[model samples]
Target: MIIADNETAIDYLYYETVAKTVVKLIRQKSKEPLTIGLHGDWGAGKSSTLLMIESAFKGQTDTLCVRFNGWLFEGYDDAKSVLIETIVAALLKERSGIAKVADKAWDVLKAVNWMKAARTAGSLAFTMATGIPGPDLIQGIGSIASKVISDPKAYLTGDVFNKVMDGAAEHFKEAAPSETTPQRMHAFREDFEELLERAKVDRLIVLIDDLDRCLPQTAIATLEAIRLFLFVPNAAFVIAADEGMIEYAVRNHFPDLPAATGPTSYARNYLEKLIQVPFRMPSLGASETLVYLTLLLYLASGVSDSSVEFKSLLEVARKALQRPWLGTGFDRDKIKARLGSIPSDLDAALQLAAEITPILTEGAHGNPRQIKRFVNTMALRVEIASERGFQDDIKQSVLAKLMLAERFAPELFNAIARDASADGSKTISILERKVTSKGGKDADDDPMADWPNIEWVKRWAAITPPLNGIDLRPYVFVSRDRRTSAGIGVAGGPVEAMIERLATSTLGITQVTKAEAAALTPEDANRVFQGLVTKIDQTEDLGKRPPAAEGLARLCGDRPELREPLVAFLGRLPVSKIGGWVVSGWGVAVEGPQAQEFAELVGEWATQTSNKPLSVVASLQLNPKSKRK
Candidate 1:
């Protein structure tokens, strides 16, 4: 039931409208060369939109469309050469029936090949004259030269050396000695334009995608190649990339350019000059996200996009998206009316979509790819629980609620996990109250006063099917893998050595070891602390105090600065998974100003309804006088 992350021709996000507009613009300006920039953030569906534009040009005999992904040619010596070659190849294939067109295409290809050879021959000359191989020499030879260039001695050997010299000589003999670079470039463009005229191509629309995924060098090179055909009649280029990345590439390619030589930045000017028409992909709004999610969930349920049922749903969703501010897109009645009847699975999917949309919208920032990923992850988790035989226990709404926290507010999620675990009850009592009731109350009067003052929390709390008394251990258990730990891993030397001693069993860590752990530099101590926290997080059972706990206690006892962080670490541990050993082990670690904080924590543990043993121990710790004689 996984939704694929690849770019598709599906008009799920209404990008087809944008594509159609772009195609119309190209047609209106088909007589002149046109360069259009399709700008969007990664995963914002730039690639998919490009596909829509290409699809729009299908069956237009007068117009030819060719697709090229710059990322595929990332490591090539010259991205410009490959791009030119690609366009020529596409032209040749398209006009294969015209014999004269083939000859003209071959001539253009020959010019590209000569340009490649010139680069190689120049590199060979530089290496022989300077007794040092240039970077261009290695790049010019391609994969075979790259492999042996590291060992210059091996590069000078028999067949490989002969091959390089022979290729350079052949290209040099065929090259036009009197032609300067600018003149050659002009001639190549003239030849290409003549070829287009001969082939009767009204407009050669080359769709360039994934330029943002390429290296700065490759990205800039591809843009440079497009500039060669910038003025050639009947040539139109539609480039899809993140504008920011391309700007960064421009800055990188020309490091000496001033930050701003005019009203616009240098990089901005470069892109503005090259890309005449720019279309920025819009981020999905809340209503659009809801409609998108519903359609995706339907697809996940085995509803094929090609089916009449799916098409009908898509039409409704598109209409709703057109005016999202009116209401949440596609209510149940509307769906049922359109489809005649809603399957139970689809009804459940709709319910789930509604349940998660509010938080998912804000969390995923309305990116289609991100929303799709979240859906895929949620569906996979449900399948996993079903396979593990606890499917019935894991409700979709509950899991969705927890996942919202997991994805957006990880610290909050960890806090909830600790609260749920404190008494082995698996329920979060802090969220039991209605969100609206918290308003107008004094800070001290509100139970949620201790929670972060973020708006998303309120929205999440107001979501239907409150988590109040629901046992969430099964859901939490299924989601353990998604948990993030604060540990930075072991820093080598004394810090690493200290972790080893502290990680040992109680009997293994002697008083001398505790003294050594306490004397560590604050930086080293924090590192050791983080390492221990990571170890405890990975430990399968919190039923007993982990061996690292004592070392953490001793380290914090000496370093008061770590007390707040230590309390935070303790607060994140699942209480239900822990045992009575946690109630009294801190000793002097919680002394001084932090003692009240620790005491308050213990008092909360004592009042929790879950984990009787832990509650009893915590209760006794707070009131030793009440202990049995």
Candidate 2:
């Protein structure tokens, strides 16, 4: 699917067109050194993008591009040291073309044994190394290396070049400052101009990319250096950037930029002086993106079944594209009108299919881990159904499987089980004692403490049309200590209530089955209670229960008899299974039926609800345990 074209080298993809635009712009402006800054997120193709650009212009234009790591030069102590090294290296590579012209120039400077005040040794080497007329670079390089070895250091650092230039300033009848580094600079600049002039015999362009990858301060300074100080008129600068990222960096470094300097607008105005008109990348339209994703899904999956189709697949893309970037919004009606026509039988399956698209596609939402998980999950079920030959039922099974997995996430069942532990028993009892006086408004302690556990609890809550679980928080009883000579009663009773809470919560954690109490693995049962205790402190909404369930389940481990008693105790009344758990038609607590009496109550609380039976189901699940069904 990746067809890289312009600066589109294999390692560096895309931006072929942009790179061409950049090259053409700089070539017409000047035939000297050009600086280009490529911008994007750290790995958003900035460095590699320019490398491809560099590759394209290599032979035709006397061009050079380097991906300098800002961090690499951090040890140099200051920006100047790094800048000098980098630019010198760049110039040397540029001037030291096929022939080695800088050879003689370097030999003259080195023989003088000069201390570098301005001219860089590397730049001098390039000028002296590249312009020779010989076919081989090394032949000329060796010729120069032989002459300059004795005083190589002086070629860049010394007083010789400046002394000669200054000595000639008046003789040439020039009036520029003769304090002489600039005169020496004029010497090198003239040398470079001549070298490039001869090498290309036409034009040259230098493109520098990935300045955006630099740390905030470094990027600003690097950009400032080239733009303001080293503004080579002949070398056109082609810089790419996200305007916001650069401005934010400036604001971070100088608070005054934001506070006093009209920081919000300053950087934008600053960039105006430098940035040549940008070649903007166009955004993909929703309908176009939809078609792109559809084709990608069909290609990746190989087969699209009735269980997964294009329309619903788009919605799945919605969930996968949850990140703010990429603009993954769904115009439901428009999408339906467009894709809604794709073979009616495939609608449900295609939507299911689309759900897996973002999982497969690479973009903001396309984290490989998320992609693998979605495929593993949905593909497993799809394969199973295909083998069984239940072609028609595949869509339902896939949805059921997804919903089943949802039940297990920290968000739902797991979270409820962890929070509904005994550690908060004393706290709840204390709240009760304090709240009884006004009967004052109940102080909301940790919301986690009283949240209902059990799959039934969740099922009831999600029920549409005023089911038994509709906001049934009030009737939920917090078992308190019975009054005694010790004032509010025996603290021992609270622990017993905690036990009852565990037994009830356990029914959800591990489904109760018939078994004998004696044969039950006592330790397994005990750890279930213990595990709940351990998890309460660390529990968040996506709560994790300790390794207590399996151990507790083993209490009856292969012993059916022992589990039977507890199972019967749990089975006092049947709780209708809503989705995963069985619940009685009562409001949010115990399992029971109260259709006639609760009718008015359901109607008064929620008049529009058509399904009254389910309303009472929620109410009962939240109620304390009624007799076993």
Candidate 3:
């Protein structure tokens, strides 16, 4: 059920080299207490690493596997009594030499168990199931008598008083040793050694699993107890943990106490060294990720092993990922159709898929959990596509429509911004208005035409759309200027333009590329723009203005019906012999100008410029209730 484990006769997917190294780390330890540490980013495979290594050392004569599951025990082992219980319990579970004297150990364990109950009960009365005490001063005595009535292990052969007193003294001493501080000492080892001596053994191997999942100090104390107390003459311990998480947890939990006391860092390191055969784990390779991903897709789609359908999905994934918007092995269509069918409430599923793919493929920058979320969202979109028959009938609830549009526009705008800023290039100007989904009106700014660089503006206008279109139908491309020798301002201030005059340029572009178009690279796109520059500069004359600069006299080359409102038209400049808008007006008289007509037209123009933008406007007539100065 928990796939966190690697190889345990389950559906164990193989990862490379991690398991073997961990085994080697465990197998090669010296007399010092060994603590093998396995670590990984959460869900990146630490648990699996632990289980694989655990399985590897299962029955080896020198190997003892103890899985210290965090959930089973609740208290911090530093509590004098808790540590004793943990060590004794862990040692018993193992096939240690101490196990041979199981009867004696069991008797000792039962006595220690009573320590908790007797401490809870009042001095004279030992609490029982009936909450009754004996007539005289019987603590554990009367209780033991009642419970051990027939069993010899519980029965007393000698003076039950003397035997009980000796056993009581030994039990307290073993639980809280006198030699070292109660919390820091290793008397549990002394007890274990005594038991092992009775059983006749030398070395013991124990596994501590899921220790990393506990509070760091508790986990550390358990390890410390295992290291110093519950051991034979030669003892080995292999602990399972997320090594980094464990270190962080331990450091955060204990702070200076563990480090300043002795070599806490060194002790931690020492423990780590014991895990000599620790199976190190790395992320699955791309091929392996794909294999698992395919398997996962097949399962999520509920399409059982029908080779025909599986193959069809694979084909869809392959083809869909080739689009510029969707990276390879990442088809948005496949994601929506075959993953989680995205719960319908998440209307931004398509856009989320587009954004997530980069993260998913980013070098184990993502894990299986993230992978699942992505698949789920994609699957949702697929369900929509299926229900709608890939047509328009799939009712996009208002929230969903708004979600799709808002999510799409800003991301697209950001993508454009990033593209413009990429490779240390500053984007001085962007001609399009970034249209997010809140309004019908779009951007009122387009400064590319007025920039001083005429030829650069020429090529930009030629290649880019005339104006920002809301249909999302335009093909975006990046064209690099490939010309090694072109004029300075040909393609917007050429490299080394101050002293240079000409630049050789090249341009190539194919518009109408689908959403799934081949990638548009900066170099290639720049080159295409450069070609357009070459064409425009080759034909246009910068030497002498064409009689009346055509662009100045009219709206522009394509749409010449409207006039440029930015230009000021004046009747006369008395000082100069010019028949154009004048900077100074002396003796500049037009006798038939209409005042009321001019006032209304001027008011309309002013109002419209502020409220509704026109691409081009001719002349202003008048603002009513106004007169010529």
Candidate 4:
């Protein structure tokens, strides 16, 4: 089932508590305008919280809510203008009798446009004064002025335009202006508040979402416009973004900011002045993550968050989540009882989520999006496995365990895949016993020192009881995540299954023998060869070396076209990797002149390379000519 990634439900993230607090804060009556900063990392449910906040205003006549996404207009329009126009448009749409008020707001918004153009021209003049060629800056300012002048009446009649002309006339003068900057700012503020009063909107709450996703210029434009034109009594702005991103935008917006040269106190002070109230979203802990995972799994399993059963569970869990002292009512049994016999895959997912909650939460940095991505990835891997006829063979818990390794302990996971592919059936048996073995403290003292991969395997094996004796190469083969699929390792599609079959059974290599390799079409052979190269390139430890070597050897012996690439790739490997003996033994598999050619190739590699990889093999050669390197 495809999970919805966007915010649709109010309490899916159990954010109602925080949402209520925001609602309370926004709903309070105050004389001064307020800017509430909702700060959280991306996908930490900032948008969802915003949605809940919007919901809180439903059925209220006195408040008008306007939801705006700054990212949508990043390049299409000026963010400053879009935000101003949007609020005015929303207010006009709400009260049909307020068109005149919207017209006045529109005029003030037009004045904002004039103010921006004047500033741009001033900046261009400054750049020229500093001996910097600002032809492009000049051209951009001209282009903007042209667009504004295209609507001549709006641009010409604006007092802001008159103000700009007045300022330009006194460009180099020391005399004071008829109006100061603060007076102009106050004029726009008064105009906006009058529009709200005219519309009978007691409070205008503008919810700005995805400010973090916008470009630096756009983000700053939105924030600065709200501060300049919309900061008035009975008007509030809620900005949802990661504080770091906004701070980054701030740095980019004002590159010469005082904090840029020293400590960041100036930037913090700037942010504090703009965002009067800061509300940071709390990161999910272990128990909270578990509840979140269970809810997402329920949603992914075709159960809607609006369903009565899910809502009941969410209400109880949300209360418990709000107050830890209340104790959670969302244990596994409670979830199972509420969900009532879910699909086996979802059931397995639920169990897997609980088992790996701690590590997964920590590894994912307690981000809910990462957890959802993990679940989505696991489901995709299971679907891939099922497509390859291993539907009944792989279990969800087993898949989750392997994915945990792939996601969190990547080096250790790669080691397991490399070794397990070579040893096949015996690999799992050995690891199972290795973990269960009651070795004394000495065996455990440095389990991680000599071979950390082994220690990782032991710890992993001990997590769940059902992974014993299962040949895991197929799961590893099918669980090729695209993000980590680059470099040396398993890749997706038909070749992955082919490689799994070849590497799993070392007994006579019957699964993909010489005959089978010969029968493969050229396209299929190339794909398989490339896939093998990736695995061979990633094989690090010796215990994990044979599978890649054996698979490469078997394919090279059968496909004549693969020989040169194989030799070239092997030549690049260190002496410790594709050793002289391994190459010579593979030569035996090839037979005839190819064997002698392979030996000569090894001799050539040893001659040019200083490591002398073939020294031991050269010493055992009966022909004295072989030791020439």
Candidate 5:
């Protein structure tokens, strides 16, 4: 069973404590206008924490809590107006029994409508009031309004402008004429304060989530809306977002700000000024990750999250999380002791969690969402193997071990797959011996001597139930079509488009393609590189240089940070299987300090006794003029 990836009010991961602390802070400062920044990375349970805080304020008559997701209103033309209208509408709905509260809400909506019309009509209304052209009349209006006023012919038509003005007149029928934007803002705030007083609400707590998912413009607009209530009494806002994304939005919204202003960046300064109290969500450690995974597996095995049994297990897990340094989690004895008896499925779950926790903790970087995703993926693979009638052959422990390599060390995983596919025996004797060997760390005499000297390889080999003589073809076949652990799927986008073009472009990558490759973010570039490597791994013949080979070389040339991974991939390739073309095709990608490493690799290839063809080719490259001069 797959775990749903949505936010819940459950106290998993011990986030309820953080939520309770935030709720207490809001209650203590309910009368004053307050803004608390609930900061975390994506999928770090920020939304779940928000739900917990809202749950804490349940059934409280004096304090009213409203939830607003900026991402939901991202498509609207004006986020600022949408946020204001949402709060007012919520207030009116809750206080419908009060006399004239609906009327006051209608007045606030009319004011919001006026603000909307003014944005469209631009400085025409303000220009008429001041009787001047240029920036002087556009002082109080925002930059967008000023642009419309500065050049009305470009942004506004005569008929559209008149319609906007007519709408404004209809909205403000009972109000005064020649009312400037600043005056309208002041009136809107005063009216909102009055509505809060009439509603008799002691505190208005607005919880905003998913601000990081919005575009730069929407994010900034929502922040601007929050600014309106900064001075109004009895209003508190809890905004949840990734601080880095918000800072990026700030930089995009104000591109002219200096990179370094005083001690911090200008973008950070803007966020600091808006969000008064900031709470950063901590990433899960190994022990906490173990507890989380164990609970999830229990849920997958039909243990209801709301049941008393689950709650008791949750308490045990939370206590274990408190002293994570002890490295103790929900072991088999603990589960049996609490539940009085362990289900057959839960026994398997405990074993899988114990086996996968070490690497998964480091691989997922202690993110709960990532850990859940890994567990879901493993469960799905196990189901697939069972569906294909090989359930007995593909044990959960063995599959978990293989998936750890697939998720963390992809290059090594690919090599193992290649070896399994090349020989019908479905076994790599060298790797089998490496994992089964019990000795000190000596790379010089290890069967995995050619593999990279990364700690992950050592840790993976040290895992229980080593693959000494298991027929891995079934496991490899089941996991063949899975996505890379980078979370990038086969979705069509700019990066995927580039990858497709580079993979099949027989004429070679063009200058436009090089520029495009150079423009990719480092993370996207790595994804593209990984995609290319996957393509190379699937190819039947390593003797010929596929178009993806050229693409890899060019990408490495564009992004030098990829050279090390490139070298590692080359080192893992079967020397006898690959062609001599691998000897020297990276024109400028291997230069500077990397050139020496390339030379050493070539020297090893030249002396290799396995493949004479590769050795001869590498030798020729080392001394090309020996035969001519």
Candidate 6:
């Protein structure tokens, strides 16, 4: 299922209640401007709540709602200037006839540009009107004069220098009449209020979202901009961010605060000064999560949330949830009536929601986006498997149940996968017998009685969509966790068994099956090395070529006695894999005598063919340390 990872069209979390409260607060006819902080952690639906507040002013002519996402315009030199320009432009766009307001807004932009130029010219700009150059200014002038005289053709009469001088002169002249920073900010406020009056807006609500995602500088700049609007009448600012993150930004931006008044104190004081009112979005509960998952699944199944019938059904669910005793259980018949015949996928999603809600709620820490992400990840896995003609034999619930174990009970799940890898049919037989056997004398005498200790494992084994008598290799393969790939159907043979042990074992330099590598005699090592070479040769994707070579390298790196075996392995390899390995840095793993022997083998092969590239790479790999010098 793929619901859009954005604000919900329906109020799944009842955040509209919070949004309404915010709208009511902003709508109040206060004499002074107000700042309300909508604080929540990342993905706690702060953006969605902001959207809901914007919706509250949809058709109202008296209230002008504007949203600014600080993260969208990040990396700018001055976030405060960007905010000032963007707000003025939006206001002018709303009412185009206000020429006086537009002119004043243009002056704000010009003043900001003048200040930027003044900063660039450095301390000399302070004495531009005194008609006497300071030492630094004289030094700058002398450097230019020397450059012009020393290289007249290269530097004299160059338009670039003249343009730079002209620009600096213009800024110096313009800045003499430019208003001070305080005077300009006051003027901006007056112009802003005039524009609001001209537009006939009773209240201006500015919703700033995603402030927490910005860096320290940008976050502080946005906060400072809000302080400018905090005193203007009939204006309100709602900033959505995590309070903790904002505090962290404050601490980082102002790092040199005195220890007695420290970063924490400054951060708290800054937050209090800016955000006078704070509202936090509560985390989702079990019932709420189930309903949310069901709705999301329904939407993903192509149901239109904006349809009158769907909205009515959603309202009914919301009303039922508000009742303490009735709970979140919706009337199935009513929903079915509105939706027509329920799609089987939707039906399954609803059922899966009921089964997985509690586990998902706990695992996700009551976060809605986390639950959505979990479902999206599962659906993508299933979709990809189906595309590859794999896992078509399994049901969705089986996948969900397996994922539950993988996500929440990781150790238990990995153990099950390993057990299946060691022996699939035998493991399945044992589990089936243990789960199905009646509690008689045989059950009491069962030797593996205490196995599978995790609560979720027991629950999984007992759930429907029975897994008895099935080879779990496909399920484990679909999981896509590389560590669990060992459990995915190993063909029985000494060579294959050796390969599995080598590939799955995490040890030695390459971290590949150390015990197996240590156990091999020269002859067995030769056979196993040939087996890895054969596997790499048969593999079509070159991406899968490195691990086998790495395993061989680690084997030889740890036990140099296997150098002769590595020679045989290298002699049999296709020149392409060798060249690819050498160029791709897999040669670095081949150390000691193994590196020398492998390089000699490649050198011999290169001589027998016309592959000059292989010859060059072989020489480099043989004397790899020469490149370091």
Top lDDT: which candidate number? 5
What is the TM-score of each predicted model, taking all chains together? Answer: 0.70, 0.38, 0.40, 0.65, 0.73, 0.63
Q: Any runs in candidate 5 off by more than 4 Å, and if so which?
A: 123-167, 171-178, 423-432, 435-453, 483-629
Clashes of 3: 55
Taking the tens digit of each residue's C-alpha lDDT, what string does model 6 give over 174-285? Answer: 4324334444446667766766777677888888999988987789877777777877888888999987678656655654442113222445566877788999888887
Worst 10 residues of 5 by lDDT: 123-132
Query: Candidate 4 at residue 130, lDDT?
Result: 27
TM-score ranking of the models: 5, 1, 4, 6, 3, 2
CA lDDT, candidate 1, residue 444? 38
User: Of the candidates numbered 2 and 5, which has the greater lDDT value?
Assistant: 5
Across residues 121-208, which tens digit of lDDT does each residue of candidate 5 receive? 5533332112233353245444444444466456557765654443344565544445456676678889888889889889999999
Give the per-residue Cα lDDT of candidate 1 at 431: 44
Colliding pairs, model 1: 421-575, 421-576, 422-575, 423-610, 423-611, 424-576
Tell me each candidate's RMSD, in Å, in order. 16.0, 23.7, 28.1, 16.1, 12.5, 17.4
Candidate 2 accuracy as lDDT: 0.37
Better of 3 and 6 by lDDT: 6
Residue pairs with colliding backbones in model 4 are none
Report the C-alpha lDDT of model 2 over 306-335, residue by residue, as the tens digit. 334443544444443443255454434435
The models' CA-based lDDT, in order, is 0.73, 0.37, 0.37, 0.64, 0.74, 0.62
lDDT of 3: 0.37
Q: Positional deviation of 450 in candidate 5, in angstroms?
A: 6.5
| Per-residue C-alpha lDDT of model 4 across residues 58-82, encoded as one tens digit per residue | 8788889999999988887667767
- Identify the runs in model 4 with alpha carbons over 4 angstroms from their true place: 119-181, 260-264, 325-327, 332-350, 387-389, 423-434, 437-459, 466-468, 483-629
